[model samples]
Target: MSFRSAVMAEKEESTVEMEETNTNSRAEDEELADGKEDGLEQEEVECANLEEGGGDGDEDEDDDDDDEDQIDNESKKKTDQDKGKKCVPGIVYLGHIPPRLRPKNLRIMLGAYGEIGRIFLQPEDHSVTRKKRKAGNNGKNFIEGWVEFRDKRVAKRVAASLHNTPMTNRKRSQFISDLWSLKYLHRFQWCHLSERLAYEQTVYHQRMRTEISQAKRETNFYLASVEKSQTLDRLRKKKQKKGEAVQDKSWDFTQRRTEDEMRLEKMKKKGLSKKNLQKAQEKSKAIQEKAQSNVSLLAKIFSSGRSKD
Candidate 1:
């Protein structure tokens, strides 16, 4: 009976010890699960923060693109405004352009004064050009010119200062001794000059056409007169060859009475009165009767003789 009681106490002690060990192992497993859950939550928070930062960078790039577009639009507007602006130009007339002075040289010389816009140099006359070319002088010459200036005030000032002055100070220059004859023309535009040139060209062409027509008409008339003269000559030669008497019919116009004879006749009429005129008529009648008696006696004698024979 003592041995069985001792065995029961040992079994009870061993079972209590096993129950405490199982409780400790369960507590350790719960701690491990909590630690793993905390690590997962930290990783998720970091990923969300990185996504928000990336979204902010994309928004900053969009803002930069919008700013660049606005800048471009403003610049385009400024360029358009500049293009819409207009400027009024002025003109200067040159009375005489010297020899060997070309438009290029003129521009180079005058560009020092102000901004030059348009330049026109009238060429020398064609006849003069031909003569010079024949003489072995082939250099181009300008008769007159017109220059455009950006500003009216500058044009006026240049014209005033340069008139009657030497063209240049350089002694070796070809135009050193030449004088400037400049005049500022008010209210003159380039269009007016163009119109004038066009009109002159049209007039020149019209005159040329008229001259050619007149020359052709004169030539035709001359040819016709020559042909008529030749035909008359040929007819005269044929008549002579055929032994025909070519009677030339000439018309003689009566001569007009002289003023002196008319005056003398008028004087005689005025001097004779009505009485003298009747006396003259009676004497003329007596003379006519005597002449008729004589003629009748002669006819009687001639008839008697013929009868006796």
Candidate 2:
């Protein structure tokens, strides 16, 4: 090959390699710029995370205030009760669980730290569309309640010991899945319920707050008794309207029918009327008289029988 041709080929090869080098250098510059931008984005994200964490810390501070208040009230209640005074301790209300906390499970888990005395679970009964069925639906029936160890100090210990442990269980929903449900009751003191009756009475305490409205809060028996009284009033009104009432509301017999009519009316609607109530009164009177007569008779018979023997 000629020397001039070899020189030309060499120049062409060098130029092509220079172009490739330039292209690769440009690509590397772009990659470095991209990495810097990604780092800036990540830094911004980290800053935002810090801000969020700061806000959560504020919320935690607010929660601490509520807990402090609860503990104060419970302490005061115990003091009053210890004085042997008619200690009607004011109840402290705990707001909804922060995230995942079952009051019952938390109470039990916290119980390890203190003695739980009496736990009362009262699910509110919300009014339903069906007047009767609605009347039957109690919220307390849904939200459970419990009494923990009688020792309040232990309860506080459990609260401190179990502090941040995840207390979630299968029953907990996904929304609160991350937060622990088992925590201590801040001001809950332990009290033991003796006998079934006492336990039932204790149910009035530690009820759920479903019907938050003040007017709707009521006990089962209180509401049931009110319903019964209402029914009786309606029945009385019905009898009055029909002119078949046995006695006047004021019990003024002189203004109504004779005693014979009252007896006949009672017979006609024996089941509907309070026949047993009246019959029971009369039966009790008769029984007392008979018992007195029997006592006298027995005494006489004893004397005579002994004489005869």
Candidate 3:
């Protein structure tokens, strides 16, 4: 073969090798770039996943806070209701207790035993009333009040535990051992407003006003007429000691009023005659007994008639 042909062959082979190397280098560069791009893509995906996971955790935390707040509110309301002790159905209506039994220390002592609803220290309004009442026996003071509990069982336990206790602090402390088991109250009822007794109070006031007015007028007239009348003549002469001889004819002017006269005047002013009061009381009692007997007889007749029918 010619030398030129050989040289051309060698140059062509070298050119071919250079071209292949260039192509292989380009392929390697593309593969490396692809690998880097794949790594970057993976990192970005991981970042996105991390952000999503963190957001989910934050949402869960928020939900947990809401649940906790709701529970707290519910518990607070329930606790308040129990503490307030709002009386409703199934509450007790214990009868009026006497004021002297535990006037000052009943509540203080009873409260320590259990959660009492209220210690109503007023009289019950269970009687018929009028518009205006007189201050008399009909004026009831609800000296008794009831205690309420959240649970009926608790109420029973408290009630059963409060009776016959030493309810005083003056050398006497009431022991509440017996009052913890009281039960059987359907519901509690309290009296709020009662009408005043009209008729009895009217009569009492009218009579008093008339007597006072008449007495005042009579008193003024009596006081004024003393100077005009010969009061000296009517006045009883007082004797100087029985054994002494009287020499002076001049009478003592300082004889304002005898003890007897003053006592008579006081009696009249006060309208105080025991005989008169006794007679009046007897008449009233007689009338009451007669009316009661008549009522009893009528009731018997009605009952008999109804039974026959």
Candidate 4:
């Protein structure tokens, strides 16, 4: 009976050990499944973040495109404004305006035809101011002026009909002769005039500078000047000889035939048809004779009447 009881106890111990091992394995499997599920959820969250970032990047690109478009539009508008400012149409230039004519009076005369926009009168020359002042002149003689019209059509009409027409101003109710000398400036702009004036001034200054430099040049020695003068004389003689040779070659009057001479020769060779001309002359002579006879008869009748009176 004792042996049977010990074997039963061993079997019971083995069964309990197997049950603990099985429970530990089940707990480990459950933990591993929970970790896998957490990893999957993290991956899904990362994918969602990547999608949202991609959308933001696309939105940024669209905003950049819109900014570029706005910039382009603004640049175009600026270019248009610049073009409009540079090319001003319907502007006319009136030159040689009478200095006595004030801007107000000029507008009054021109305004009869059209609306005036701007007027520019040439300024009095400062270099001549002193001379003019000494001559008892207030520098109000005649000034060159320009007039701008508002409408191009009105400017054209006025320029056509009013060019070279005389202008007159009243003085104490006496009728003064008008000397209207108006000219239409074609394709002439104020800027062009300013440019020309600037160029002329530059040229004048350069000429003055050159003249001063030339005057300041060292004088040549007497012997050297004599030699130079002799050389110049020789050159002049050579030029004269060359000119004479050229003249001799160009105009050999002995052989040259003028158009009139050539035509006379041609007519002599061709024998002109003078029959029609002779007929015309005879008819004219007959008419003259008839007129003279009529006049003489009228004169005789007048004489007879005078004698009777």
Candidate 5:
């Protein structure tokens, strides 16, 4: 009985030791799960703080950029205002403008760049004679002009940009094919154009004088031609009269006549001879008078025309 009781007690002690080790293992597992949950909460808090700080920094950078842009715009405006206050009047000349290009269109074009002041264009010539036109003597038809701008700097800029460049129109259908053929006169001044125009006027008057003198010279030659043709007609008529006289003489010789008839014939011939001499003298006087009148008429016409000119 004693030996059995001792064996039973040893078995009870071994079971108690196993239960204590299991309880200790359960406590360690609970502690590890609690630590993991606390670590997750701390990480979420740090992430939220970092996001708030990043948003503030981004807003600050955007504001700085906008401030810089505004400053630049203000500086540009100031410079443009200064340029307007100090600019002077300026002029430019064009050498070869197209016949169809009008002043209004040019004004509209140039006004886009700057303000305009004055414009001048060469007038078209309308003095071509019908004979020359019929003989296909068509001359060159081009125009030249000058334009004054409101500001000298603007004028210089426009001249530099448009010089040696072809002009094109996009909005108007009529000018679609009419590219402007113009040459900007970079070296000429407005005063030079005025001087050249005055010179041209004087030259034009001199040309008119030369034309008047030439017309006077041709007048006498034209009259001489008319007189020469008139003389030829007179000679022809005289030859016909002589031939008729010869025919009459032949008839007179063939016919027989008495002495009384012959004496009567002689008397008639003397009377006809005196009449012919008088007619000849009158005709010569009339020719002299006509010649003298023509000279006076030509002189009067030329002198009157020159005086009017």
Candidate 6:
């Protein structure tokens, strides 16, 4: 009985210790789960705060962009106003452009004096260009040019100072020996040159159209004449084949007397009446008949004398 009681007590003590250990382990698991939930919640809050901060930062960036745009617009307006106050551009005419001297080189040389606006270089004639191309000369040649300067006084000064002077002082320059033939055009604008060029092109086109029209008319007239002649020839050939006489439809009109001959005739008839002019013509005819009859009778007499001999 004593042995059985002791075994029962040991079994009881082991079961209680196991139960206490399971309870402690269960509590620790619950506490860890609670801590994990709280950490997840805190993480969510931090993410929300970060997202809100990012949105605010984006708004701030947008605001900065808007401010910059406004500042840029104000600066552009100020620049425009300043530009409106600037002087009108001046034009300079180049009578002759040296070979190998281009607009870029010209600008580089003249840019030291003042600001350049627009540049136009007149190309050589089409015929000259064709000849050059045929000769394998690919270099472009400018006959004349016009340059716009920002200031009128600067343009005038540049023109005056550069005219009759060497293009450049450098010894190795290609245009070193060439002189500038610049002339500042007073009251001239780029629009004027464009208008002039437009007018010239219009006139050239008009002239070419006129010439072409005239040539076409001449060709049409020549073709018509040739066709008429060919038709006449065919008609003549058909008439000949039919053994018919080709009738001459041409008329011989009486020739009119000149003014001098008419005047002489009028003078001769001035004092003569109709009856008198008729009697004079009759007398001249009778004298011509008598002279002819006398010559015939003398001829007959001479023939008779020759026979008697």
**Local accuracy of candidate 2 as per-residue lDDT tens digits, 1-309:** 699999999999999999999999999999999999999999999999988799888889999999999999999999988886543222122223442344665566545545455555433434432454566732232243444554444444554554455544556545334433344445443343135436665664434344443446556668989999999889888988999855645654557687656765666676545676567557767887897788778889899999999
Q: List, residue by residue over 55-156, the lDDT tens digit for candidate 4.
A: 888889999999999999999999999887662435555666655667777788888888888876776666677788888887554467778876666777
Ranking by lDDT: 6, 1, 5, 4, 3, 2
Clashes of each: 0, 31, 26, 3, 0, 0
TM-score to true structure, per model: 0.55, 0.21, 0.27, 0.36, 0.40, 0.56
Tens digits of per-residue lDDT, candidate 5, 136-178, equal 9654343678888877778888888876655664656455544
Total clashing pairs in model 2: 31
**TM-score, prediction 6:** 0.56
Which of the predicted structures, 3 or 6, would earn the higher TM-score when compared with the native? 6
> Whole-model lDDT for model 2 versus the true structure?
0.60
lDDT of model number 5: 0.77
Give the RMSD in angstroms, all C-alphas superposed, for model 3: 22.6
lDDT of 3 by residue, 1-309 (tens): 699999999999999999999999999999999999999999999999988799888889999999999999999999998888854423454453542344345556555655555443444444433322543444433444455545565665555665444334355434322232234365443232112335546876998899999999999998878754555433423334344444545776765897546755666688978786566567767887898788878989999999999
List pairs with backbone clashes in candidate 4: 166-180, 167-179, 167-180
Measured over all alpha carbons after superposition, the RMSD of each candidate to the real structure, in angstroms, is: 23.8, 30.8, 22.6, 20.6, 23.8, 20.8
Query: Model 1, 229: alpha-carbon shift in Å?
Result: 1.5
Predicted model with the maximum TM-score: 6
In the range 74-182, model 6's lDDT, one tens digit per residue, is 9999999999878778999999888988899989988998999999999988889899999999888999999999989899999998888887899998988898899
Model 2 RMSD in Å is 30.8
lDDT value, residue 270 of candidate 3: 82
**Alpha-carbon lDDT of model 1:** 0.90
Model 2 stretches astray by more than 4 angstroms:
1-115, 128-147, 161-165, 169-309
Q: Point out the higher-scoring one by TM-score: 4 or 5.
A: 5
